[model samples]
Target: MNLTTKVNVTEEAEKLEKVLFSQKFWIDLGTTSLRIVLILIFAVLAVKIGKVIIRRLFRLKLKGPIRKSERRENTLLKLLENTISYVVYFSAILAVLTEFDIDVKGLLAGAGVLGLAVGFGAQSLVKDVITGFFILFEDQFSVGDYVKIGIAEGYVEEIGLRTTKIKSFTGEIYILPNGSIIQVVNYSLENSLAIVDVSIPFDVEVNRTEKLIEYYLTIVSQDKADFINKPKLIGAHDFTETEMIVRIIAETKPMRHYDCARLIGIGLKDYLEKEGITIPYPNLVTKSLTDV
Candidate 1:
């Protein structure tokens, strides 16, 4: 090789190395990193602010004269907060990818196709979301409501967009998809009726017993917080050979029917016994023949 040619080639190689290790290159890279960090910080702040705003708006709505339930308000607030967070985070991620020179449009197009495929495959999931929305919108049931859906009967612990968590009386938590809930029996919507039957010996005076029970029920209604109205003694309900059953019905607060019934039964028994009324019990007659 000639001397001048070799020198020129060496200078070109030095120029290339200088450009690669230039301060401008590091500065540009640092600027990009700072922009990504700023984007993430803004996204987080936006989500937080959005959530606060949503909660405040819902709180205002709750305090208004329209009078919405606490559970429904909380459910709506949470759903809005989640949606806001998701949107903000997604936008921030897209902006970061753009800073890195990634093709966000192409990525979004591919994601759209993939999402369509997933949506087709997950029809039940879509149904669940749709049903959940209607459940919230229509006020079908709320958190802490005692409900019976299919074979699952429990207090609703959590209601989400896709699933509901119910805690049974026996301490079992049932996670049920919203789409699976077709028929729901919400026991908390109205007052519950408590029916109690007291058995008395056939010899007892029916008219006097009924009057006494009615009086006692009036007293019970006054003392019990659960009672919505005074209980009524429904005369004689069932007749057996040994005893006659008198049925008492009481209107009580929701979920308090069982306790109200139990208290009424005990009070009736004590009162009846005090008034010299005999409560009948079944007798087992055993005949033994030893003479044969």
Candidate 2:
């Protein structure tokens, strides 16, 4: 109740106010913010440098005498880069949170539980990732490979842990989950058989036609490097009332079958016409009832 007591109490209150609103408090906040910014910058740099190192290492591995397919190398490089980025960014986030005195252990525990719950709901995603890993490891198909999956056929543009991107011949892009790929037909894996069917008039001599085709095939094999082997005349494939279907089979380079078949067809037509071989056309005969 005395004046001295009142002055001493007032001095204690002023000291408390100064401590609460001091420049040091603001400076500490600013320093924390700067640390966060620096951490973010380091994270970005880590990702960039990690990517560069990954690329160089893979490049050297690919160039070694052991010899790896380009597609396999590319898939691994992308997978490594993505994994490095995720890990580095996650660590950087934790570091930044620690700078602000946040409880990282509790956050990670919560995240783990949340991830478990999400995992139960996202079984398909996990399946897709597992399937993708198998696809890469087994070398089933790679980027730039022309493949047919179910009804979708196209050149593979990208293969990720969850999905695959394919660009079709008609310029349509298809994104399919890796788990959904049950069967894959890779057209680039081996030589393709070019089958060309030629229809001739039934009246034409079959034996002479066969010999003529075999002779022409020998010429084609010599001229076109795409042809892996000489064409084989498989005799008559089918018989119609007006014509006989002859089948020609040729082994050509992968993906060149269509072109080779087309060229063979043209050449056959030209040769048949030059040799006066008749190609059958349907002829319709109509009789009037009145005349009958």
How many residue pairs clash in each candidate at the backbone level?
0, 0
Candidate 1 all-Cα RMSD: 9.0
The top-ranked prediction according to lDDT is 1
- lDDT on C-alpha atoms for all candidate structures: 0.83, 0.82
lDDT of 1 by residue, 158-181 (tens): 988899999999999999999999
Deviation of model 1 at 46, angstroms? 1.8
For candidate 1, list the clashing residue pairs, or say none.
none
- Candidate 2, residues 1-292, lDDT tens digits: the string is 9999999999999998987799997899889999999999999999999999989998788788897777678777877898899999999989988997999999999999998998899999989999998898778898888788988888999988799999999999999999999988888766777777788777888789878878887787786888887888877888888888888777777677778887888887788778988564312122111112
Give the Cα error of residue 147 in candidate 1, in Å.
2.5
**How good is model 1 by TM-score?**
0.77
Error of 2 at 258 (Å): 2.4
